[model samples]
Target: MKYYIGLDIGGTTIKCGLVDETGKIIEKDSVKTSIKGEEILQNIETIVSQFKSEKPITAIGVSAPGIVQKDGFMTTGGAIKDFFGINLKEEIEKRTDIKTTVENDANAAAFAEQWKGNAIGFHNYYCMVVGTGIGGGLIINDQIYRGGHGMAGELGMMSVMNVDNDQHLELNSLSFTGATVFGLLNYYNHHSDKPEVTDARVIYELADKKDKLALESLDFFYTALAKGIINLMVALDPEIVLIGGGISANSQFMEGLQAKIADLKSRNSDVRDLTFAEVKPAKLRNDAGIIGAVYRAIQAN
Candidate 1:
């Protein structure tokens, strides 16, 4: 059986995994992300060497943050400032002498869903990863739609609020300062005089306990997110809208979001006319990037 190495590079950690052709993870590990570009590459090389000692790796796949071109060039590396303007595929191939493929993290997640996760058999769908901010991936006609310059699925940049002034419109974007976990915590902490909480889970628990401030903040979050999903539904009309991220694992959050969407649809006649896409939690979760990257590698080879 041919084996592959998948690496998911994030701001905090670089998650690595070994897998065969069938999408099953054989082993997985992670290393703390480094600020320096060379250090990150070295870490990747070390991981590849360790994995290679155990099995002959056929290729390497990478799932990375920021705007990645089809040729594996990172136009903007998100939190990884050092990755900007670099060709990661060539770099990895040079270091490890293995064929390598690179993909955007959110798009990789969508690929994971298409391959073996919640989006299987769906010809068209959207995947949104809601965390500190939001990231999106679009699958059209069973293919990842990387638009001109590879900036197709940037859903977080969509403005949900109107501003009198043009400047700082990104601040009013759906996910930037509104419909995310960070936004929820920010809203709660700013409004509540009670000792500030950092975690979104804590706020959720407070809401469960009927804390007025927490409930209000969650209402804002749910409303903003519902509006964003509504916009996506009206525009793309996908078969399903899959949500991913740490918060998606919380059943309460998912149920609340679904309920909020339903409430909105019932209130709006225009939205009611549009076919509603089923909102579901992504099945792959943490392993999505790794599995999707490997899937891309498999396709490349």
Candidate 2:
């Protein structure tokens, strides 16, 4: 039985796990992602050793937040500045003397969904995660399709506005967390004259309680999110568009979103088969990235 390691290197923590070809996380572990590459590499090496103590590992796979190149290099992203221009593949190999591969966390999550999660057997689809930030993955013909420069799935930053538009609104302004924060703080500023309320959790808690301002915040989030999904669908025309993230866990939001999408589609009957991307919760949730990372490693070999 060939064993593999999946490493999810997020901005805050590194989730490492051992798995077989079946995608079950056998032995899981994690560590902090340090600023120094040497220190981070050492942590990865230790995890590999720990996993290897019981299982005979054949390869390693890594999932990080960036555009992963085919040349075993991950591009630096907006959130994690420490990984910029770093040859993470080389560093891990140097530490463990084992070959490995890396991919974008979004892409990894999408792959896991397609391979073993909710979006399985779908020929063409996109996966979006509206968590701390907005991002997603693309799959075509049952495979992760990283277009042109392996950055095709960076949907959040792709044309939130039109050309020659002076007062264009970038989509991030309406991100899941951003919308909630804006509404809360905007309300507080106008009402109580406070500083800011940036946490989405507060928005969730308040909304659950049916707070007037928090309800408005939830509307802001769902509206933008529903609009984003509709726009993505018009472009990609995928059969299924899986939605994930912390906020996606809310059933109320999901049902409301489906209604919003249906209403939007009803307004445009002439446009193709009027269908919205089915919004479903992520199956593996947080573990999808690490499992997908392991899948990539074994496939690369």
Candidate 3:
């Protein structure tokens, strides 16, 4: 029964899981993410030690946020600024005296889907995780395609709008500012005269009740996200587009997003001839990174 330690490092927390070779998580836990790199490393060590004490771990796998190179180097660490230029795989190996493999968080999620989730039979697909911001992963021909320099599938960086206000050119990409939960809240609060709500779920609930402000904000969110998906559909023409994140659990959100995409495609003549990829919610959900990391570890062995 070979076991692996899976770590999902995010801006707010580090989710830890002990997974068997079969991809089932035997146990799971999490710890607060630290702004300091050293503290983060120590946290990983602690989690590894705890998990190793209970099982004979074969290797460690990490789902890390940011632009991760193939050899486990962090070119940019997203919210964890301290991780820039650090080789997390080497760091974990040094701390635990065990083999380690690291992958981009979004890519890990996509891998999870390909392994045992909604994308089991699909070889070509795209995955987008929409939350505080948008993260993307691409699977082409049954392999994760991490383009030259490992920056491929960075969907959030794709510019959706060109702002030319005040005689200055500005580009708005699909990110926290426009297409995610953060964007929805910001847009809603900015327009609503009542008290601002921080939770995106609240806005969804309001929209369910036919609240005007919430509906408007959600429309904006879906429109922005649909546009991004439309762009991907035309360019990649994947078999499917799997969306992952906490918000993806909401059936309404998924339906609304697909509806918006259909609306946009109906109005566009150029893309009408292209076959659109089916958009579906990811199955692994919160456990995606953990399961995906473990799957990567299994492959490494």
What's each prediction's TM-score? 0.95, 0.85, 0.95
Clashes of each: 0, 0, 0
Residue range 29-124, candidate 3, lDDT tens digits = 999999999999999999999998999999998999999998999999988898999999999899999999999999999999998899999999
Write model 1 residue lDDT over 70-189, tens digit each, in one string.
899999897889999999999999999999999999999999999989999899999998877788899999999999889898888887755458567676787755545557887788
All models, RMSD in angstroms: 1.8, 3.6, 1.7
The top-ranked prediction according to TM-score is 3
Alpha-carbon local distance difference test for all models: 0.89, 0.73, 0.89
User: Which regions in candidate 2 have their CA more than 4 angstroms from the true location?
Assistant: 159-199, 267-273
* Stretches of candidate 1 exceeding 4 Å from the true structure: 162-167, 178-181, 193-196
Clashes of 1: 0
Q: Write the per-residue lDDT of candidate 2 for residues 1-301, one digit (tens) a residue.
A: 7889999887678898888888888888778888766677778878888887888889999988777776667676446666777777887887888888888888888888876888877889888866556678988888888788778877666433232345445533434223333333444334434455666566568778887776775565565666677777888888888877655676776786787667667777665376555767877777888888887887788
Q: Which stretches of model 3 miss by more than 4 angstroms?
A: 162-171
**The CA-based lDDT of model 1 is what?**
0.89
